[model samples]
Target: MPRAILDGTVLAESPNTVVIEGNHYFPDESVNHEHLTGTATETVCYWKGTARYYSAVVSETVFRDIAWYYPDPSQEAASIKNYVAFGRPVQVEL
Candidate 1:
């Protein structure tokens, strides 16, 4: 199982994760929605399409743009569509 943790809190965990470019993309249902705050940020990935970001809020701490997902991924990366991946400030454990 792979897990995403922030500030000692588990944000997402799943056995069905997609690993792309060394990052584990956890299924949407496996993530804790309570810890995520949607952001207006968007970034384009040549292969993955546009990625939307989320800020992880644990207790009183907020990690901005620490997580992202592609709502509609490119054909080559369709399997990871809508899956969440963590970046800096968010720890991922496999």
Candidate 2:
């Protein structure tokens, strides 16, 4: 199993994460919703489709758009649709 931790909190823990390149994609429900503040930031991945982002807020400190997910992933990466993935500085433990 692998877990994504940030700001000393475990955001996600799962065994069914999809690894694309080196990033672990945890199902949306696996993430800690309380720590997320939805944002308008988005990026497009040529093969993975459009990605939506969420800022990670810890106490009074805010990490802008530190997590992302593909709401509508392409066919080649459909397995990770709506899966959340963390960015650097967020610890990923296996």
Which candidate ranks first by lDDT, i.e. highest?
Answer: 1
lDDT of 1 at 78: 95
lDDT (0 to 1) per candidate: 0.93, 0.90
lDDT of 2 by residue, 4-94 (tens): 9987888899998999989999998788899888899999999999999999877668899999999988998899999999997788999
Candidate 1, residue 76: Cα displacement in angstroms equals: 0.4
Distance (Å) between predicted and true CA of 26, model 1? 0.2
Residue pair clashes in candidate 1: none
What's each prediction's TM-score? Answer: 0.96, 0.95
lDDT of 2: 0.90
Colliding pairs, model 2: none
